[model samples]
Target: MDNLSQYIDWFRHSSSYINAHRKKVFVVLLTGETIAHENFSHIVHDITLLHSLGVKLVLVHGARPQINAALSGAGQELRYHKGLRITDTDSLQIIKQTIGAMAIDIEAQFSMGLANSPMHGADIKVSRGNFITARPLGIIEGVDYALTGVVRKVNAEAILQHLDKNSIVLVSNLGYSPTGEVFNLSAEDVATEVAMAMQAEKLILFVPQRGVMGKDGQLISTLSPVQADLLLKELAQDESVARNITLESLSAAVKASNKNVHRCHLISFADNGALIQELFTREGNGTLVSKDNFEWLRQATINDVGGILELIAPLEAAGILVHRSRELLEAEIDYFKVIEMEGMIIACAAIYPLDEESGEIACIAIHKNYQESGRGDHLMRALEKEARKQGLTKVIVLTTQTAHWFMERGFEPIAISDLPAKKQQMYNYQRKSKAFIKTLR
Candidate 1:
């Protein structure tokens, strides 16, 4: 019992690697089918948490359900064509109001952040634009689109300028065509166009039910575009694919990736901190799609730092990783675990025992060339196993970069004094060096 107590205590108290990496900017598509009050709260929490990170976010919201509800309440019937909504004259009017509610509701919720965690932080910039250009789908199989439209082009440079100035640009799926005609676009289309134009690091779509699965509320962590294309083929053949939000979203993501967006992520609005989970954790609370399965983690040996250093040099040069002298790595030689593919170490992490029963992971990183594979999670699980072997029950981390990551893995934050004595003595709380902890019990 004493041993168990000691183990649990250690698991709760060890610190995390705080200064691991720099902010990886991303554009997020926030859309959903369920428009309940509960979801509104989650939107607020997600924004506040991501804003806490230096992440540059562009929020695009979906309000089709809201618009439908409003229109229906006014005794108007909804129109559709080939699973796409037919936004005629009346629907167009409701779209503006429905989208306005989403933007306004989110803005009001942002103001509710804790005073210390203020909504109006120096980096907290949120704005919405009327910048979606659209063209009528013309006629599909003899069905006229009416006022329904497809996104023709996005003024992504405008959004990027706002992003460079540290603002969150909110987009509503409405646009005006070049011919002086107004049209409505799918939220998914709007997100994809913006991602392509920005050539974003990541493009994420937040939808309901996690991923494209029949199971209730399941989240798929990884998929390549080819795999997604095949699954979408199956979905297209079967109408029973009612829950396949993943496939529904793949069209735009594939287009964006083909246009040079590095990655695409589809997450649930249901997960409490889905945004953070997808962004920071190695195993995301969402489905990540890329052209291929890229490897980012490997088993580490004391000798791999030279190889690891080669991988991180660019990040250091980019001012993402704090430069360290060779002696510093040698002094903490036993702490690294690396990822190897083709017999070459591509990623590494530095893990150490904070005390007799406590472990701390530091300098956790992936080779940029090998990122987006599930290798990071594999490395973390290996680290967890090593901690268990050493009889440490608690693990803590200091992360200026991955707070949402640690949080998703069940790590919570407390004051530095909450750590075990030896670990606390090592704490270096920089503006970017936030803290986290996880238990093994």
Candidate 2:
């Protein structure tokens, strides 16, 4: 396909995301390194596009690298305790100057409006103020952190008012005390606190790398809060890993997830258009820390045969699924996985290895009451995950009544002859089920 054709197709596919994000609140974090990178302009453009699409944005920026540079240039000693910067009187002054300058630069970037550029004709409004209230860290281990502080509260009402007026609220790492004292706060902490206070739909952190990587050197695309906590503990044991940015980013994601922020995304700031790609595309280009733990998907055992039967009985009676006896289900229980909610099986699917490189998915059924709530898609993903664990490269499904559903999910129609040899032989000639195949990545 030509570039224009691909762009047209992508635009068509992104319509759903566009509608979903409209009018939703998002809190975005930009670190000092991110703003200094060449791709900063592109990131700013994407943020502009999102604002144009009716997304209310709260931008929290950090000046860690810039502050460090300024302090070093000033012939000052840098001190840190337990991964938190120890900001003395002089360091606090330098931090305020550095953060002040960075915030102005970011606002200026948002004010760009050059013809022929992405921001052309986009008269965006940016608002910044003392939106965060902070308290001092006091002392730990008999050492005073001085001006280093933590977020005590966020002025969410003021931020929302600015958003209602169609302005993007810009926040800095500097917070103020009721006593009129300025305190240096961690950018990640500020971002998390703001997200929780605002109850944002998403808390997006622009990091240096693509996303969180496992010990195997591969990016983990999605994680639950429990899983993220486990990964955090595992990453903390390795002293070679930089604990400042990456760990803090992941830790912030976890904190937001636990505090009613539904989703937290960590994407690379160096990659141009990553913010747009992650938000608008189905296969997001980053790690998604989501709080979707209401239902559990697990491999089925013999004890779950009754629940599976109960869940699929209606489908079987309606000629949508092949009926299986309890004996047969118990025997093949190891090949099944189920979605259970509150000790009840709401969905179930089975993957049977038909060849060395292919698996057949069957008996996919969801409770009628839960059919419209994405349980089917959840079960399908579980089946695909099981197929990958078995080293299968392809998955086939035979559907007499749900061919359209499978086709909509990336499966393509195929003739019976295209099925694996064993599956072809076992195909019920009377049922005349249509075959569809999908190649796994």
Candidate 3:
């Protein structure tokens, strides 16, 4: 009953804690559903906010309604046997046009908007590449699926190459085979295939209603594939999951999770800023499917500093963290935090106040043994805590490297002028560093 608005507020509270403590890359899947213009506008606004936050979005749009309209306009009746759309030649042609128009409309909307509409307020930098390889679905349940195809392969390299350029990758649920025939693939299937192949950090599917809700009217924030399967089994008998497309989208998510894609989320096309609420917040807007715990955020403390220093000292000596003397560290002892597991520190970061509502994150270091295991991320979040307790407005980091890691965690690189006087002075001294800032409020 609280709705996504409550979740967005919760996310804001948790950000100060998460940003200071963790550092890592994340991906999200945004599955599109045709909805009323007002709801579409709301969804667009949500996407804009997420885009503004520099969150990576992989958009997979569905044009079932558009396809239906095209089919009807072309004097063809739309039909589905079981869950599969009955597509003949006419249907396939309509699908291609409908999907192309939908992609253009999405681009147009993104182009028109200030944030979510375009990439970083420049041109329409989002890319819609040729990544899918298709194969005919043939027949299932004694019905011929015909030219209807399933995704056989995705060009993950091409997609990543485009994403690395800060461009959104738009996927049409239609693909072409080597034989030169077009096949209409399920939108859900396309989104999942790309996400799984790319090993996306997060996958999100958007639907008409507020996302996956319990019978009691509460949001199901997170669910594993097994749990979702059980829920779906009951819904199969009960009609409880509301929209059927949501079920389709979720089914795709479950399958994606079983593969390498670790996290997936479903959000409402009905709410404004829902994507931002889900991506930037702790407990997101919709139901999340993953193989692991998503509560991967927490607070950091002084006790975490010693081990954190151990991780950082090597990097510091190597000229990564600016050489700060032990006396200086003792003087700023309250600024450090570390990731602890079984009473051992594996990673660390430090936070220093920039202003009443802002701070500076520094000295991020991960032990080589635990380099990619998320320990460094744990420490970055700790730094976020120190800033929040001080009522900071934002946190900045100066890194000679690690831009990609910080970007994933929602930090934006800026010029030295963006920093406060004290931090700027320090930043200028460390001429080799690149500056990044994450808004705290």
Candidate 4:
């Protein structure tokens, strides 16, 4: 396709995301290293695009690298105890200077308006203030953290006021105490606290690469809070694994997910379009950490077999789903994923890979009580992600009554001959299930 055609197609698909993200609160955390990277400008432009689309953005920035640089220049040694910085009086001054300078630089970048530039005519108002309250870490194991502190509270009301007025709230990794003292804070903590306080839709953290990769060297695209915690434990115990993981960003993502932030994203700061790609596409470019229970979706297990049977029994009796024996379900349990609510499986779906580039989406069933709420769509999308991970480029569904629904979600009618030879042979003529195929990009 030509560049123009590709652009048009991208914009067409991105329209849904544009509509979905409007007025949604997104807390984006940028590390000092990210700000200093060459890709920072591209990230800023994407952020401006989001702002233009009416997203309420809160940018939390860190100055760790800048502070270390300043301290080194001033001949001051950096001290740390158990990964917590020991900020003395002299180092505190450097921290403040570094943070203030980086904040000013960020504001300057956002303020840019040049002809023929991405920022042209993009009038983005940035609001920055001491919206975070903190208390000193004080004494820990006979070690006084001095000016280093943890986030005690976030002034969400003030931040929301700025957001309500269409201004991007800028928060640095520095907090003010009630005693009129300033302390160095962790940017991840600040972002997490702000997200929780405001109940933001997402807490996006910038990492050095795509996202959390598994031992197999592939990106783990999605993770529940429980999964993230387990991964953290593994990383902590294994030195070789720890080298490949960004412990801090993953920790924050897990925390935000657990605290009901709805979604937390770990995106690569070095990738110019990671943010946009993650937010606006069906298969996001980062790792998403979400809750595992009632409000989330996850892989099915042997324990979920009973719930799956209960969920599909109604559909099976109505002839909407093919009946599966308990033995079969147990044997193929790993092929399914379900959405549970209060200990009940409300929806379930499974995908069986037929070939290197094709799969069959089957056993899709949603509870009668939740038909119109888009649960089916959720299951389909989850299956698509799974299909992609399996190296499948296309997914086909055999349905007797849900053809129209699948078609609405971009599946197209296809003849049975188009399916894999084995699948075609297995097709029962009496049931006469319609075949629908969807190509994954």
Candidate 5:
């Protein structure tokens, strides 16, 4: 019963994400390692589920390991220049054969309809063609890259047409040139470019590990492009670290983010349901590389009163927060700061002046969907900064249920009498909210 209730709660929470992602375009990169993993079928099943939910998917696949095996079987050694394969005529032939076979296998997986399977009755149609145009990498530093190429253009119109028809578009790491030659390409690069050209809502890359890790080995859930670049620079400086797949995917994510792709996610192919979790859950199972301004924090206006009230109504009903009328909020709206994502206020806090030396931080609330993701901490910090800017030396918060949270942020317990005289006179002893104060240096 408990598990069933939890499932119901989770489903209810996921409704918002479902509506947000409906009819959105997503470009997913599947490396050779990802495709070869045992969980590949599960990933395909998830993709089918997304398709059924009206998500337009463009799948870009790589075949480096397969190409290497084929080259070894043909008694040819793999050659590379600066992490890019140096594809000669013979190598290109082998790569084309390997990538084509893999594409066929992927299409077959999408065609699965066994009873009791996730893909059963999915009826997914996949489209693939000369959707990518390429130009050779050319010679660099006295070495010729031969048939190795980079994406010159993506046929966005053709891909959109397929997407409009509700077919999943499949693209291989092979690009066709105007000269009638197919050049070997990087799957990550292809995915990034396709996302940029199509203006996709998301670019999801499947890596071997559980997203980007910090020095403490914990997954870093979010990063701005600048932060990602700094991390990449730090990784590059370490001589013990060889160029790996994760770094490549991160680089691609950063590139996509810079090119106007709003969200680029790096998720693990080894973890079952990672894709779905990353997409639907608030605390995602991956690292997100996005623009810094994706979420805006600013002073709330009269237009934000409705959102603010909606955000705090549940807390007010539960007696975790004191209720305020819309008229009262509109008149004091200038004192509030809100964190807005997609024009919706997800978190908000207000600083009311109690005296010249101190202020009261009140009405702190974060939408349940955004809780536990650090928005509360962010709002608190912003409020503290605002308090300091107002020449205040101390900030006080009264909480019935979040006393520990305030203490964690350097607030110390204080008596109601310790609050400013004006605030103390107006305090309601009936609610019995605990008072805490922080001295701002």
Candidate 6:
């Protein structure tokens, strides 16, 4: 019964994403390495699930590893110039053959309808064609990238038509020129260009790593494009690190975001259900790149009451926060500050001014998942800034719990008598909450 309840709660939360994602176009880039991973079948199943859920998918796949194997099998040297495959005549043929085989395998996966599996009853139709036009990269630094090319145009109308007919559009890392020649292209380039031309809602890139890790070795959940660019520069300057899949995906996501894709994601291909978790959940398991802020502190609006209530309800039930009634919250909504992430409030606090020089911070709470990230301190800082704006010199907190948290933030313990007259009169002796105060500099 408890497991069932958890499922219901998760479904309730995911409904918002379902509603928002329906009929939206998402371009997903899969590298040769990702497609060959042990979890690839599960990833394909998840893709099928997304297609069934009304997400218009444009899957772009690469074949570098396959191409290298094919080249080695034929006794041809695998070559690269500046991190890009130098596609000579032999390499070009190998690239085409490798990409063709990958496309077939992906399409076959999408066509699966086995019973007793996630793909059961899924009648997904996949469409593939000459949807990309290319131009050669030309000679650079005396190195001619013979058959390697870059995207010049995307057949957005054709792809949209297939999407309108509810078909999953599959694009390979190969493009054609008007001169009737095929050119080797990067899958990331294809995906990013298609997404930009189609104005796709998201560009998702699968990588081996979970996501971009900060210097502290923690996954940075969200990054602005500007921030991503800086990280890319830093990575470029660091010689100890070899060029890897993560950097490639980050470059693609940054490119897509700069082209106004708005939202780009980098998720682990090895992690089962990562695609669903990244797309449907608030505070996703992977890294999100966006033009707009994914999480922000803002003054609360009437519409935020429900999210704030949901955030603090657990604390109230645990007797850590004072329970707030909806009616009272509605009346004092303007006094609340909330940290909202992807439309859900994760932390919140409200201030009730006791006198012109002082205010009492009330209902301070941070969701359990966010507490270890120092969001509580962030909320307090925001509230302190707000209090200063309101000409309050002192901020007070009454707590049965979290007194230590307040103390660590420079708050000093105080007697109940030190509180304002009205606050002292209304203090609950039965609750036995302690008082702590901080004076503004």
Q: Is candidate 3 or candidate 6 better by lDDT?
A: 6
Alpha-carbon local distance difference test for all models: 0.70, 0.90, 0.70, 0.88, 0.91, 0.87
- Candidate 4 per-residue lDDT, tens place, 1-441, comes to 699998999899999989988999999999887898899999999999999999999999998778888999999999999877899988998888888888899999999999999999999999999899999988999999999999999999999999999999999999999999999988888999999888899899888868888878899999876678888888776455233336788988877775668889999989879999999988999899886454658899999999999989988999999989999999998889998765678789999888778999999988775565567888989999999999999999999998899999999999999888879989989999999899999
What does candidate 6's lDDT look like per residue over 1-441, in tens digits? 999999999999998999999999999988898898999999999998888889999999998788888899999998889988888886787777778888998889888898999999999989999999999988999999989999999999999999999999999989999999999998888988999898899999998778887777788888977688788887775444223677878888887776668699999999999999999888798999996765789999999999988888888898888788999899999999998876678789898888989999998877774564556778888899999999999999999978898899999999999888989999999999999999999
User: Which residue ranges in model 6 land beyond 4 Å of their true spot?
Assistant: 238-243, 294-441
Clashing pairs in 4: none
TM-score-best of 3 and 5: 5
- Structural similarity to truth (TM-score) of each candidate: 0.59, 0.68, 0.59, 0.67, 0.67, 0.66
Model 1 lDDT tens row, 317-427:
865566766777767767777766444666677678888877887776776544544556777888988899889998888777678877877888967778788867766
**Best of the two (3, 4) by TM-score:** 4
lDDT at residue 377 of model 6 (Cα atoms)? 76
Candidate 4 global CA lDDT score: 0.88
Q: Which ten residues in a row have the lowest lDDT in candidate 4?
A: 237-246
Give candidate 4's TM-score. Answer: 0.67
Residue 233 Cα positional deviation in candidate 2, in Å, after optimal superposition = 0.4
Query: What lDDT tens digits, residue by residue, belong to model 5 across residues 318-353?
Result: 999899999999999999999987677878999998
Number of clashes in every candidate structure? 23, 0, 26, 0, 0, 0
Clashes of 5: 0
User: By TM-score, how accurate is candidate 3?
Assistant: 0.59
Give a tens-digit lDDT track for model 3, residues 25-46: 2344344444434667656655
